[model samples]
Target: MLSDISGGLELRQADAVARALMTDDLLRAGRMIGQFCQGCGGAIGAVRLAMFPSTTRCSICAGSKLLAKGH
Candidate 1:
């Protein structure tokens, strides 16, 4: 679907940003409550939103956070 493509783009962009500006404490994503993505400041995908019910950042961002945490 068209929506799926757009969602992938958003996640890609978020991943790039997270990689560029990542620190230590800001892990596990931002947890924005709307259709927006707190990681890259983009829109959240419907599927991603459904999967990450409590997450603010996309899957990539969440993974990066977990990596930082060593888990």
Candidate 2:
């Protein structure tokens, strides 16, 4: 697959594969975040939860509360 991607003739295939990988990664990340936040006892928002799968806090607490976690 990598060789096909580098050969230049498979640009569309490469793009499709990359997009699929990205989507899969995002879904996996969201599951991880949901699992982590289950007992975290912190406030979270819908948009933040959707966009940032590794985030532990919403925007407000992100800068102050969750930032301490080194994310």
Candidate 3:
């Protein structure tokens, strides 16, 4: 399947990519209905949403979340 098409990619990498794609699709669908930040329940701006359709959080919350995770 995806691993074969990806030239024998590791199973874990393939799984991660598949999950990310699914999550991205779900987030995009949510935006189509009505956009909101999944992190802080804030309104997501149109420019930001357009820039990152799969984003689930506003910039402030996203930055904080990343910092919390030490990333």
Backbone clashes under 3 angstroms, per model: 1, 0, 0
Tens digit of lDDT per residue, candidate 1, span 1-71?
A: 24645676544677656655664324435433355646666666779878876656666656676544642
TM-score of each: 0.35, 0.34, 0.44
What are the Cα lDDT values of the candidates?
Answer: 0.59, 0.65, 0.76
Better of 1 and 2 by lDDT: 2
Query: Regarding TM-score, does 1 or 3 come out ahead?
Result: 3
Tens digits of per-residue lDDT for model 3, 1-71: 35654896556787778878999999899767767887778888888888998777788887795644842
True-structure RMSD, every candidate: 15.1, 9.4, 10.1
TM-score of 2: 0.34
lDDT agreement of model 2 with the native: 0.65
Q: Write the per-residue lDDT of candidate 2 for residues 1-71, one digit (tens) a residue.
A: 45755777556767987878989999898765553333345557677867886775556655665455665
The ten-residue window of minimal lDDT in model 3 covers: 1-10
| Distance from true location, Cα of 60 in model 3, Å | 0.7
Best-fitting candidate, scored by TM-score = 3
Worst 10 residues of 2 by lDDT: 34-43
User: Could you tell me which residue pairs clash in candidate 1?
Assistant: 31-56
* Candidate 1 positional error at 13, Å: 40
